[model samples]
Target chain A: MRMKRLACCLAIAAFTLPATASAQGLLENPADLIWVSVSAALVFFMQAGFALLEGGFVRTKNTVNVIMKNYADLCVGVLAFWALGFGLMFGDNPSGWIGVTHFVPGDLTGGEAGFMVFQMMFAATAATIVSGAVAERMRFAAYAIGAVAVTGVIYPVYGSWVWGSAFEGSGWLSERGFIDFAGSTVVHSIGGWCALAAAIVLGPRLGRFGPKGEVRNIPGHSLPSVALGVFILWLGWFGFNGGSTLAADASIGKVLLNTNLAAAAGVVGTMILLTALRRPVLITSSVNGALAGLVAITAGCGSMEPVFAVLTGFIAAPIAVFGGDLLLKLRVDDVVGAIPVHGFCGAWGTLAAGLFLDEGLFQPGVITTQLLGIGAAFLWAFPLAWLCFAGINVVLKVRAESIHEQRGLDFTEHSEVGYPEFQTDLPHAGRND
Target chain B: MAAHDNARYSRERAVISEVLGSKLDAAGVQSALDLWDRKFAGQKSVPLIEFVNEIEAVQALEARERHELRLALYKGMIQAAAGPTTTAARATTRATSPTRPRVEFKGTPAEIVFLKIVQYYGEQLRVLGPAVMQQFLSELRAALEERRMPGMLGDAMATVAMRGAVPDGVQWGNTARMHMLAQGLYVAACKAAGPVQADRILLGAVNQAKQLEAAKVFAPSQFL
Candidate 1:
């Protein structure tokens, strides 16, 4: 009787062990992985949108240089994220300041790649924002180094502080209930503030300011291209805001609708302001206004009602316009208004989430928590970006020479021009003759 | 001209035109002619700037009218330089006083409209003082170049400069020109070099006139 009972126990143990291990191997839901992967692809495509938008807004003489810098951001950013940024953002955190594990994805088929790729796109996006602010002047070598530093350290360190634990017990910000729904503080603001820092370090482009410190207009090369780029970004924003949900569920529809509504509200609000101010109802400003709305809404798209989303966007438009003016007033030469559209508006959106939290969903100290997050992000991003750019300048000279600037970065740096057929008179043509 | 030389000349001309839009007038024509003789006729580099202690316009002209004025001035200069006995040469030899009317009337509808508006605004023009006009012109020009409605300028000067509250019935497309004309007249009324940069005032007036021309106005009264 004893032998028979022992045999029965052994058989049951054998049956359960293999099944448990198999289940552990299939821990992630296939549908979720697929959704996240697709979202990553959508996010990746935004790099192209950024390239076109930035390239089009800059002078035609520097289009190739803009394209090259944007591409380098992704290239350098992705590799940096893969090697250290992902781990630093998601590793086990006893200190709640930085991640300490998962350097290169230990599990290939365990759905880690999906998460890594999505996050990598976001890291690349953050890195690229500085490209526009410093476009037409930054040296490629310095820009490459800066891209690596931003993606590798400056961006990820702050990211870990806010989103390190993924809603678990990973970081101090998360512990304090600091909410940044889709990284208004983490991604956009970091990029925006960094752009501000970079612009300050680089100074204004040639002919941007007068001897008396007067502001001058440097119009973009092509509105049609800018319009198209904006549309692409608008379309990709679904992935930007929607994919943040990290699921293929009903919530995506609401997030997407909120994103669209805010963008539209931004356009209307900006146009109204332009009409009131006696400025032309420029398509360029409108596009930027819409982006401001989108950036602002990104923080609270998931938490707030659609109405608040519209309000957030409506208010963001003016902030973008005025904030850009403020930067110029201070002599910071942000070429693409990224500081206003992303940095200022990003903070507004993050705080708005706290003020406009859904009825009865508000936590006791969430607003304070949001402010802390905003202050922290600003303090971290701006100073670090300033330091990074300053330090890089010491090594590689962050800004292109004045002669190179007059020649256009395309011809001076890349030995190419975007519109060579039409650009027959290179700056050096007279000297060459 | 060689093909490359032509391209350079056109590019420089375009830059000058874009930068000096709507500000081109009788005085501007004289200045351009002087500049052409001193610089372009000798194949010298365009210095990319024209200095004027103070320039003001009593009327807003259409961009087209200012463009035509510029084209005519350039053509005349080229003819005078290329042939010493042409009518253009004779015209070029005549002394041009800043206050003299250089733009002629061919009785085209656009020119008639431009002349009429200039005449109307001339009566209302007041010299606000050069400093005030200079600052105002700077604000207005920046606003125009940015294609934004002049919120800063409007807020700062609308009470003193505008003819009246912008009418509710005004078409959206015409709003910029209306504000521009009102501001131009204010600058003209307040003309006198105060604290404003002379060159900025002059360049500002020329650009304002060019903008007016684009909006379909003709010759505006030039203030210097």
Candidate 2:
């Protein structure tokens, strides 16, 4: 009788104490902590999605090399972000331009620590985006150095201007009410703009352009892998947008619904456009359309109504297709259409967030603030990334040698091949070597 | 002795059948096979060298087609001889038989080198497909006209079009002209198939030339 009574009292107290503590604001609700932590894990799993997508985008000969770069993005990105990026991004920022305190934080409250893990995944994602853009030809060491630059300085510093108030002071853009609910501009566009600069500096892969300046098609090796990767990313986006709420609240349901609707709309839009244009509905382009939709909806997923989310995603398909064509016209060889899917579409999504707000759609001041944030991302990321790439080129020769390229980076850099039995041109017997 | 002759005849006929099948359509292949049987009806065995010579004189085939057919015949005969044999036995058979014909190039060292290089490029272009080969020939004609070597262009076109079988009464050009022609072929291969393949093709040609007695003194790297 005594044991049963004590057990009953303990169960009652366990339930009541959390409610009291949460109400008093002394401790975080356990449900909120679990949600954010799970979401952080989902975001981290996106690194594997990136690896598969990039690996599928390149030739079989360079697949291993591309996967290695993705691994570099996660491993190097995590360390760099933990050491310098977190403090620079979330530290006290009275200047409204950059963070001023908290480098390599050891002591933190539970909520701050969870936020740090979530943000660390975002930084790693920003670094990994460049890997696909510079696939097949960029030197491995140069890419690792580039990852460090992105995670350590470029992404965090730019991130500070928008999301710097996690610990103490506010960001200039946030102060101006620039609405980026889930970092369409902060994470995706920053990464995309950095990708653009790196690609421009690195130049195109060998034989990408013909002698007559014609654009040749260098299709990726595996469409199935690309499709699987997009699906994984789509799954991860749920946590990405939902977890940004920082609590297990009623709003997560609507945010996730918006996200899924946009992705579906993106696929439909791409298929319809391709059929109307008399182009074959390519699986590769369709998956990319799905990614474009996901990227576009990310900024506005929380604030926009479901209908506008569909519109945002549907519009992003054409933007991605046309943006890819424009890059080809400009002689830019983006391997996996990273520039269109992330950079251009991200900017559009940022704008859509302001334009499609449920409260008051298209408020002039909100639109202007969003525009400033978009332009600031481009202005800040591209030039600095370009200079970094050029500097790496001058110092360490960022481009692989013609001999190494002919032999494939897998054999030359890592001394392994993805599909050895299928390959007839072993690295040893080639004349260029 | 009678059983050995029967086995040899079967091997020779099978080799000829396999070679002709790749080069001709169904009806044409059958017709060629019938002609082979008729020609070698009473013979104990058709020597591969003699059969190749007979193929060279076949009036129904184009010169390039005959050349391709002869190359295929030689490869098939070697494989047939080595079939189901131990490595040592295959090596002994190859050493003792007259099936392996040594190609004798009748030209100065540079001319021999030129012929070997052109032949190698032609073979590689054929492997890359007919469209690539046609494009290369078109490019070569334009390049030759730009260099104002119309007479040389005609000879070059004839030699390449005929799979490097030089026309009678033609002059073997100097090393410089050969180098220029070789470089043109390299460029065309690179444009069609990319540099990696072009380099491999050129290296194979150089190695082929190095094996020839007459062209052994010439530097292979210069052609590349």
Candidate 3:
């Protein structure tokens, strides 16, 4: 009887041992935790890039104003995302329309916290894009309020439709095989659409058009700052796309390579196009081309082959250039070309993700899914943001008064000036008086 | 008494006609002159202030036209007080007079007229802020220098830049140069403030100079 009992215990041990080993293998890796944390840090650093890019693009009088908006939006965005956006985006999605649990995200696992932090940066990115489009004219307080609405409601609700299954039930869009690896449509295009709405409601800057409706060039103040900003964004994008894998794996090598190839292809394509059009190869347009490429590849970087990524980015140049001209013809003043580089290129990138899928190129069903997702993003983000801005305008006035605009927002809003030494002729330096 | 009244009426009518004739027809001019005469016919001397008040009360004339007429009348009265010297002779006297040591500006009529407009706008902008006036003059000088203006025009702009104002007794003889300078000022004001404020400043300056013969010849709209 004792020998039989011992044999039974050994049999039970044999059955459980492999199961325990498999469970241990499935546990989170320390390397993944470290990589994700570092990537989140890199993504956060993109805010500085945004600040420099926007500040350089505005006039000297409005430089400080743009920087302030960039800085403030991050602060407002992070807190709003932390309070509500993370949960709405990644919580239990019983209805598949919105997440219903995990508000404020307490007592989370290490992996969950890292994910929340990483996604928090993306929310901030979406919030900050509007600052550049509405630069030189938007009221600071109204912008802060708009940032809250974006991160808390607009961005997260849409994000849940694509990425909600991270914790629980799957989103309908993701279930339909709509693949957005790192959010060309989910992040950049949503922000771009919001920017479009805000810019439309705010109207063009004074004298941007002539009596007969001719377009005028409003050159940015600093090319060096713009160049520096693009370089920083390029560096940050490696982490942006690579880190989306959520693991320290060999796939990151392919993702980073594709991202870099796309950006390079973007610059080459822009230079070639400019030469073809008999226009000067301008530094600002070149940098903007690089950004457009980065935006375009963000959706498909994980799924696209290197050559297809290059094609995706190359095509984005004309979209950006002509998209800008289209806005001018439509009388929409998108300062710094945010609508073109982010919005139009982002949509193109989403479509490219479907067309350039590594599994098979130009799958009609996949392309249709991508088109639906892209259309949904514009429909969801634009009108919602327009209503928000119009409501904000009614309540708090989103556009600055013409008198205050003439004095520059830096002086009128912040009691500061970017170049005080050059302003020696001005009374009291930074003071409005 | 009737002869003296006729002489006063003829002198007043000439000044009024010169100012209002372009804006008003002959019937309107006659009505304005008759209204002035009827208002002050019994008085031994009519005060300039009362005369201006009566012009301001006229319903048919625009406020701008009334201001022009008032300015023209004041100039006529001053010329009459200074005796029968022609404008050229008075200008020569001022230039050569020992009591007033400052030299007179000897540019062409257009140049002098444009300079006066510049000074007028400059003064008006100064009322807004000294910095505004400085920025306007600086932009004007920059525009002048950008054209590589030669001779007296360049020298005049340099002096204006140095003084941070349009200096007295200097000639900017070329009408084109003056037009460029005015355009520069408008552009600068647009940058410093905005197009609306810039337009307001230009309109005010042009209205002040509308009665001048040279202003009609140069036409502020050309530069604008």
Q: What TM-score does chain A of each model score against the native chain A?
A: 0.91, 0.92, 0.93
**Residue-level error in angstroms, candidate 3, position A24:** 13
Local distance difference test, each candidate: 0.68, 0.76, 0.75
Model 1, which residues run further than 4 Å from truth?
Answer: A1-27, A166-169, A359-364, A427-433, B1-224
Q: lDDT, candidate 2, residue B176?
A: 76
lDDT of 2 by residue, A1-433 (tens): 9878865654454234221111122117778888989999999888878888989988777898999999988889999998888867876666676665566777766776778888899999889989999998999999999999999999998899898846566789989988888889999999999999999998887656655666767777898899899888888888888888888889999999999999998899999999999999999889999989999999999999999999999999999999999998877878888889999999999999999999999899989999999999999999999999999999999899655665578877898888877754442432343
Note the residue pairs that clash in candidate 2: none
Candidate number with greatest lDDT: 2
Q: Cα miss at A206, model 2 (Å)? A: 1.2
DockQ, model 2, C-alpha based: 0.05
Candidate 1 vs candidate 3: the DockQ winner is 3
Off by over 4 Å in 2: A1-27, A424-433, B1-224
Candidate 3 positional error at B126, Å: 19
> What docking class should model 3 receive?
incorrect
Task: Write down the C-alpha DockQ for each prediction.
Answer: 0.02, 0.05, 0.06
- What are the TM-scores, per candidate, against the unseen true structure? 0.64, 0.69, 0.67
Q: After superposition, how far is residue B39 of candidate 2 from its true place, in Å?
A: 48
